[model samples]
Every structure is written in C-alpha cells, then in structure tokens.
Target: MIRLHHCHETRSMRSLWLLNELDLEFELQIHPFDKSLRSPEYLSLNPAGRVPALEIEGDVVFESGAITELLCERHSPDRLGRNPQDPDRPDWLTWVHFAETVSQHSAALTQQHIALYDDAMRSPIVMKLEAARLGKCFEAIEGRLSTPVENRDYLLTSGFSAADISVGQAVYMARHFVRLEAFPELAKWYDRITERPSFAASLPPEGAELLYKRDFYEVWNG
Candidate 1:
C-alpha cells in the first residue's frame, strides 16, 4: 500500500501531483501544517517533520525530490524518469531537483508572509531579497525554455515528465510571491503544464484549509 502525508499548497503538492500523473493508487493523509508535524508520530515518518512522507511497501520516503525519483522509478520509469543510460538523464535530474531550489525561496517567503502574522515579526528586507531570488530562478527556467529546440513544450526534449511536475508545483508556490509576467516563456510553460488534469487534481479539496490564503503576496516595501 502506498500512503502520502500531505499539506495544502506545500512542497508535498509536488509528490501528490506526480502520483496523480502516474495514476497510482495511494491513500492521502492530510495534516495540518503546524506543530502537529513536529509530533513524535509524524517525526518518525519524516525526521525533519516535513510534509510528504511517503510510505510504499512498508518503507517511508522523505523529501519531495526523493519521493518523485522513487515513484517514477517504480511506476513510470523511462516515461517520467530517464534511466542512467539515457542522454537526458542528467538534465532530468537537474530539473527535477531544481524544484527545491525554487521552493526554498518560496518556503522562506511563506514563513515571512504567512507564518509570521505580526508586521514586526516579518522582515521586509528578507521578503524583497527572497522574491528577487525567485525571479532569478524564473530567469533560469526562462533560459532553459528559450533554448532553440523544436516543439519545446516541456523541460526535457523527450516529452513531459516528472521534471515538469516537480518544477511546475514549485512554480505554483513561488508564483504567489513573485509574478511570472517578466518571464514570458516561463509563464507560458507554467500555464501549459498546469493545465493537465493531474495537476488540477492535486489542488487542495474544497473547504480544505490552505497555507497560502492570498492569491498574491506582494513584497513589503518598508
């Protein structure tokens, strides 16, 4: 049996979207994104107390990237994952993991904008810096997408894969803090990937509590 611990609009959304894309049967355990994660029971599943502790065949997987790799290997190898022998393997790995690079800034911005309720507890400088950093990540993606290639709708030359899902979900979160307007290629790519039914299914269910309340969180100017 496969089970995934998830929280609304967090990194776990990447794993959830991948699972949906793979058409895997798994149980979803929604956890409140708060101290409940730090509880001993939850910590046992993920020492870091992060969302997305996946249980498969009696083994638990932590980290979204690791979960994405394992799931693709077990279920969608060659389709969502390129084996080591494949030329695109290196690029696949790079893009799959790059999701976290984008997410780290989102995570920090989430903390600054959402977690800290009080204005004094939030740092305007940190918010601006992190949002600017997210723009850099978007620029990197824009460069990749802009590379001269025929039918370059996805990250990999082969086709759509977990790399798209991983980075797409990360962009989903990052977009709240940083607009995609400046990067036209990235914006178009994001819209294309997110239109997939699987991506839509990964969204938090109706009435479900959300980590990000606002559609956009503009950086504080103070």
Candidate 2:
C-alpha cells in the first residue's frame, strides 16, 4: 500500500498532484503544519520531521524531490519521466530539481512573514532579499520558456511531465509572494499547466487549514 503524509499547501502538494496525475491509489494523511511533526511517532516515518514521508510497501521515501523522482520512475517513467537514454533526461532533471531552488526562497519568506509572527522577529531585509531572489528564479523560468521552440507549452520540449508538476507547485507557493505580471511567459505557462484536473484535485479540501493564508505578502511593514 502507498501512503503519503501531507500538509495542506506545503511541498507535499507536488507529490500529491503527481500521484493524482498518475491515477495512483494512495492513502492521504493530513498533518497539522506545526510542532506535532517533530513528535517521535512522526519522526519514525521521516527523521527530518517534514511533510511528505511516503510509505510504499516496506520502503519509505522522504524529501519532495526524491519522492517525485521515485514515483515517476516506478509508475510513469515513459510519460512523466525521461529515462537515462532519453534526450531530454538532463533537462528534465534540471527543471525538476529547480523546483527546490524556487522553494527555498518561499520557505524563507514564509518564515519571515508568517512563522515568526512578531514584527521585531521578522526581518524586512531577509524578506526583500528572498523576494528578489524569487524574481531571479522567475527570470530563469521566463528565459527558458522564451527559448525558441515550436509548441513550447511545457518546460521540457518533449511535453508535460513530472518536471512541470514539481516546478508548478513550487511556483504555486512562490506566487503567494511574487506577482507574475513582469514575466508574461512564465505567467502563461503556469496558467496552462494548472488548468489540468489533477492540479485541481491536489488543492486543499474545503475547510482544511492552510499554511499560507495570504494571497500576496509584501515585505514586513514593521
């Protein structure tokens, strides 16, 4: 049996979305995005005490990227994964892992804007810097999408794959902090991928608590 421990709107959302896209049968365990993750019982599944500790049969998988890679390999290698011999393998890996590059900044901004809570505890400098970094990340994606190619609707020239799911979910979180107005290509690409029904299925259920309460966050006012 495959089981995924998830928190609404966290990195785990990527894994959940991929699972939905692959039409996999799995149990979803929703956890409160709080200290309870550090509890010994939870830690047994994922020593890092992070969301997205996936259990498959007797094996366990941690880290969002690893989970994405493993799931695609096991279930959708031809469709969502570019295998070692495929021409797009390198590009696929680069873009898939780039999701975390975008996520690191969002994680920091989340800490500054929400986790810290106190005005004094938040750093406007860190907020501004991270937000700027996210813009740079967006620029990278914009440049990629702008590359001359026919029917370039997805990251990989081949077609939509797990790479899109990984980076798309990261963009979903990053969008809470950065507006897409400046990057027209990136904005269009994001809208296109998210239109898929699997993306809709990954959304936090009604009345579920969310990690990001705001649609947008400016640098800390204090």
Candidate 3:
C-alpha cells in the first residue's frame, strides 16, 4: 500500500488531494511538522526533512509535485499520465511543469520573507520587494486564465488533470500574499477548483489543528 507522511496545512495537502482524485486507497501517517521532520528516524526517510513524503514499495519520494506525478502514474494513468501516441502529450507535460514553475514562486517568496522571517519588523524594504514580486506573479496567472480557453474549464486540454491540482494549490496559497479580489480571473478559477468534489474532499476536517498555525487573513484574504 502507498503510505503518505503528511503534515497539516502544507503542500502535503496536494498529495492527499491527488490520491483522493485518483480514487486510490492509501495509508496516511500524520506527523507533526516541528517534531517528526527533524527526528533521526524521519531524516532517514527524507534528507530534506519536509512533510508529505511518500513511501511506496520501500522507496521514499519527497516534494509534493513529484509525489503527485508518481501517484498519477501509478494509479490514475488515464487521467494524468500521458499516452505516447497522443499528439497532446507534450502539451500535457508542459501544463504539469508550468503549475510549479509559474505559480509556486510567489507563495514561496511570501512564506519565506513575510510569514516565516525571524525579524520581519527589521526588513521593511525586503518585505515590500517580496510583496511586489508576489503581485507580479499573481498577475501572470490572471492573464493566463483570462486568455480564451478552447473548451475546457481547466488549464489542460480537456477535463481536470494534475496540472489543475498542482496550480490550484499554488493559487490557493496565493491568498496569503495577495487579495484574491484583485485578480478576478484567477479568483474565478480558484472558486471553480475549490468547488470540485475531489478538491473539497481532500481538505482536512475543519478546526483540525495544523502544524503551522497561520492567521485566517493569510489564508483567505491573501
């Protein structure tokens, strides 16, 4: 069975969501971010000491995007993995990579500079720079969603795919760094993604204590 080592309120949620979308049964190993990640035993599982590590057939895989790809390849090949004979295979692969490349930067920057900084009060200039950078990244996503889609409601060629799962989580995180109302198109997309049964089902129970307690404003208001 696939085993997921997860921490609440992190990109690990993406892995959980992917498994749910794939309709695969797996064991969930809940671990506290502050403790388990640094423990000697856990370090043996992942040198980076990050949450959302996957153990499959005795092999460990870390990184949320990679984990999602692995699950799709193993259990939901028809939905996410490519068919070599399909002409759209290249586009599908591009969509998968684009999610992390374009959407993850802003959220990562905000978390590192504003949310997690040790001396946030002492670095007003850096904070402003980070905010500006985040804004620019959000604008890029807005432009993409606003572009005319041929027929699909998602970022991919047809139906939802791993690209939506990856990029959707990034956009969800973006709420921490920018106001969703400011980006109408992206906000629309966010609402649509959240409404999906797969996405909603992946969320942890409400009020469940999270590993990193973030302010509500950071989560919804951005």
Per-candidate TM-score against the hidden true structure? 0.98, 0.98, 0.83
CA lDDT for candidate 2: 0.94
Which pairs, if any, clash in model 2? Answer: none
The regions of model 2 sitting more than 4 angstroms off are none
lDDT of 1 by residue, 1-222 (tens): 999999999999999999999998999999998899999999999999899899999999998999999998889889999898999999999999999999999999999988987888889899999999999999999999999999899999999999999999999999999899999999999999999999999999899998888999988765
Candidate 3: tens digits of C-alpha lDDT, residues 11-114 = 77778778877877789998865755888888888888877789988889987767866777777666766665666567667766665654455545555544
Question: What C-alpha lDDT do the candidate models reach, one value each?
Answer: 0.94, 0.94, 0.70
lDDT of 3 at 210: 56
Q: Using alpha carbons, what is the TM-score of model 1? A: 0.98
* lDDT (Cα, 0-100) at 42 in candidate 1: 95
